[model samples]
Target: MTATVGALAPISRAACVGGGVIGGGWIARFLLAGIDVKVFDPHPAAQRIVAEVLANAERAYGMLTGAPLPKRGRLTFCASVAEAVADAQWVQESVPERLDLKRRVLAEIDAGAPAEALIGSSTSGLKPSDLQAGLAHPGRLFVAHPYNPVYLLPLVEIVGGAATTPETIARAKAVLDAIGMKGVVIAREIEAFVGDRLLEALWREALWLIKDDICDVETLDDVIRYSFGLRWAQMGLFQTYRIAGGEAGMRHFLAQFGPCLQWPWTRLTDVVDLDDALVEKIGGQSDAQAAGLSIRELERIRDENLVGIVQALKAGQGGEGWGAGRLLKEFEQRLWAQAGGGAPAPDPTAPLELLEIRVSPAWIDYNGHMTEHRYLQVFGDTSDALLRLIGVDFAYVEAGHSYYTVETHLRHLGEARLGEALTCTTQVLAVDDKRLHLFHRLFAGPERREIATAEYMMLHVDSRAGRSAPAPEHVLAKLRAIADAHAKLETPAAVGRAIGQKTRLAAPV
Candidate 1:
């Protein structure tokens, strides 16, 4: 059964095959952020593959917000292909690089998948036309090629065949957008798509040079990386040339070098083929350079660089990285993420103070949970803020040089994790010339869950003598009025079993 478009039916979950590098990356990208995932791979290490994916996902998700992720999504491991794609709205197939293997997998997905579901082949070479050759419905099948470490990189190439519809492309774009990815639509289905085709052409030429003994491996790599690769990172071939040529532009540069195209210069594509000896040479050189570093070590280095570079770009644009920035803006409009109305407008008389205060990382402990000490510290800050409203503020404490924490206690209720914002509300309880008692309840932000509470007896005193002193007449009168008004007001349920001599539990006993 299908739901109407845009009807807030549950999130469109995905299924992936061949839980290797590419499949693992997809799971990391989607499932960690509360999107469901299903995987089917005959390999025995499929579970390990997904666990690695989840680990990478946790890292990526942690970078997005100062606080923890909303909620983890569901992931199911299916024993067979049919079970994985049974009701999945999207399926990503990443089996071995064999035409027959892909054709069979597509056939299985076509048979069991819903008619509206979109199926993508993560093949680096096979064209969409060839992959969908024997499919039951070729229209739903397309090449949704993703780069390695797909969760970190935002670019996805969507190559469609003759049967593909505009609506299908639109839906694919929406899915990519939801997960903070940029989808580029390739107008026609071509072999090896854009990025791969460009790299393959370069590879063919590099192989030819090494085979002919014209240059060494390191030399060729250095030439490209130090020269053209630097420019290409920010701009493509066409645009880079346009800038180089200046006002004369690409036409001028092409006119100068167009004749060189006919010269027997380099046969990167048609001229040189991947013979065995050349492959061995390249492999030996690669191993020599790589030495003995584990994949995990390499991945950590890669993530650090990606984070740094992307963060720089995002910083330039005021916090929206290239792909994620677009999604972050759109996410703000989502109802669940936004603050709703009818929160009993702020009371200006007893004004809820502290415009804003951020909870820091240091407040967390070795268990990776928020330390209990911080709970009282934040509530104390809130109480101090409320005290300022009635005139028993810093000036009073500084002049007297003494303040009392007479009755201070906290109920250890729920746990708060690292980087979580802890907030508290102070409601005036009772006030006298000598003692001002206040009640405060602390809550974890974002979810608005209650964490702890503090009932304090603040004494105003003289700084020179460190002895209890009555507050001034004006401050005393204002405190009395506030306490009188709030005396009839109710307290929240977080206040456990009446503390000291106070009994203002808002709810029924």
Candidate 2:
């Protein structure tokens, strides 16, 4: 039952054999991608826990991207493994890590699922070969390891066993890609794969730090989070080190730091004993660090923080070498294209509906409303949309002629809270060869109550010359057309208002 890439259809329905943390996360990821999920977990609390995970996933997804997503798929709790995998196009086995238990579950799923369906094991460290041993259609079985909070993180490690075929790996990659996951295929089955091995190494060192009483759990976390963790978020270790070479590059860096590797700085070669006393000490410290927050609360904090960091990266705030942010931006563009499709037809009779956005948790201030800065961002996005509508795209900008905002006046009429939907409508007030004036209004909810308004004056620039220039003829024609259509509507009163009110009385002493 080896399945080729061409044979694999977009997975409309998926099955999960276990509904623990990892399994439930898988269900959330699938459901968020609009794939119906059938889940089987023997524990009575499975349904409740999975539902909680799904809720968290929904929040994370809402904050991750502004691109429109498909409607959420259905979820069903099945009575048994056979029932769960019966009609699934993809079967994900996330049972316990024990080899025997996983093997039994894999066999059950293999027998029940269609032969053409791809079967993936969510084993963290167990070899896929052992899980697929003695199973029918073993070629379809492979490992699809994912990070925690699966719906938010995009990386998924795809590993195949001895009996697994290249076709199976290809099919798995295709499915993962469709769901907005980056599938890094392992050339050979290895213990813990790449990410876990790196994580395990760090975990071992962190444990030794605690065991040796060198630092508490909180201090260790701060050390990483406030320093190297930030560095790793964009450029990883190698690139960071290369930059540290101070004009000499990697060769110089290695020469200077190579000898320090022999120093007793790390305990990677030795194992730390996790005695009862040590475990209690570590657990107590962790609990105290969290204060009184529940697991769900901690997860929300984590997801929100992750979204903020990724968003920063996407904005290029982490600097030029931020590879992760660059990748994220590229991925979001793809999602936008998939959702928005081809260029929209110009409509002259009305204000152009340019941008639709969901207020991410990161955009909210301490007052629990969208912060003032985000209004500017929304208006900027709307302006960019208008540019695109009039034939100014990446190529136009690259050609050295594009619009640059010279001035903006924003009026905040109301408040927008987190997760609230926002839309921006743009009207081309006036346009000439060198300058364009736009008035944009922000509305909230389906009824479209006004939330804010922005008036922008932009000048066309020949970027190479660093001076004003007439826009290309095609772009000017489009803008003129939109302006002509908008002329039928009454001018907004706020369009020309100054920041201060008119003085009704003479200056008072």
Candidate 3:
């Protein structure tokens, strides 16, 4: 579990301390987002914790991918915190929320981690100032608080203390961004931070309501579940209230609430802490209401609800923290210095297209098997080899001419799995001035048994013309040789697709 920096850096490995809910949550989020994770938790249930967290993460990622996740980033469970932190660029500590425990972990992390690495404590209430008191490099330590189910939630509040540096914050932000997270930086570090402070204020008011017999816990939840809570899902307080005032907006709402600020209303302070008895009562009531639903079920409901709300906001076609519909325009142009996006596939008959390809771990799909699309891609590779030999260069196409696949017939004969070596061979079946017929066969590399076969009809095209055209002289000559050689043998039925309208038409029919 004590992996070297070299091993994790290639894939951007992160370290998580404590395999409890929060630690496990961090591991799941990072790993599922294609970041390798090294975990250290003394609890015997660490592996199970990781497995369950992975399962949850996988489910969440599945929603995004619309299929099983691609080969996920690797996961490593460490024997100790030092081993986990040894080479990690980002170390997230989720030990018990006790100040001494955090102080000890941060101190140990500072000793083991690289001087430039960021060490974040996932404490909901403890201030970064208190946590950094015992650290050797206090600047590297900060609060990286995440809401529950970090895998699904995109928001992370980054609170840095007096000793924390701007560079450290930027480094942490870069890592989060790479993992598809949106981070908001707290201007200044404070106890309970922003999110927790807001939640605590609500909790304090809710407690007062329950204690004074104003409303039951479920009823208070209903008020939130139905009214402002619904609006808050997409927009926060000020924005929601601004909309409530119509044309008057924020200035109007502020002017209205400004007068009520001094009036005695609900308490937002923590003077009435919920002691153990109250905590137990609330826990019992929650269990009574939700005992029928499993934790996994609850997570599903939560994620689905979030996705619906966020997607709705996104549909509104506005900017963040406002209407959902934001117009996103994407522009991309590839400089065609050469003709193609990739090197031509190795030829099977000639030295050019023939290649000994080793199957990588990424080739497998959600079924824990090689996917059909990859086989097609490999065949496409073979076609590229055939075209390159005949002078169908990428530059030629960019200049206005290209080859288009009119038809392809493919068959999977045997299963190909990960770590398998495979061989692909492409042979020309027929050729004319404007079209080339080709077939490709894939075989298991070691045993030399055929695994898949494909036959395709390739049509010469003037991409600039958007129609078929005759091959250039040099290109036609290469196609002639391959086609002439294949004509000696019996061609497969799939390779005999009918030729379309050729390039020499004087006028439209």
Top model number, lDDT: 2
* Candidate 3 C-alpha error for residue 300, in Å: 2.7
Clashes of each: 3, 0, 16
Q: Which tens-of-lDDT digit does each residue in 160-205 have in candidate 1? A: 8777778878888878766667789998888888989988888888
> What is the Å distance of residue 120 in model 1 from its true position?
1.2
Worst 10 residues of 2 by lDDT: 1-10
Which is superior by lDDT, 1 or 2? Answer: 2
lDDT of candidates 1 onward, in order:
0.69, 0.84, 0.69
Task: Name model 2 segments beyond 4 Å from true.
Answer: 1-9, 317-321, 342-354, 361-371, 384-407, 414-421, 426-438, 443-450, 456-491, 501-509
Cα lDDT for residue 272, candidate 3: 69
Q: Lowest-scoring 10 consecutive residues by lDDT in candidate 3?
A: 327-336
Work out the TM-score per prediction: 0.63, 0.82, 0.63
lDDT of 3 by residue, 79-129 (tens): 877898998878999999898888888888899988777898899989898
Error of 2 at 497 (Å): 2.9
Q: Where in model 3 is the C-alpha error above 4 Å?
A: 1-11, 66-70, 273-277, 318-509
TM-score of 1: 0.63
Total residue pair clashes for candidate 2: 0
lDDT of 2 by residue, 1-509 (tens): 00011111278899999988899999998987768899999999999999999988877766777654566778999999999999998999988889999888889999999989899998899888888899989999999999988877778899999999999999899888777777899888988888899999999999999988999999999999999999987787999999999899999999999999999899999998999999999999999999999999999888888887777777785543145455567665555444433434646788888777778777989999999999999899889878877777666788888899999999899999877778899988999889999999999877888999999999999999999998878888888888999999888989887775463556689
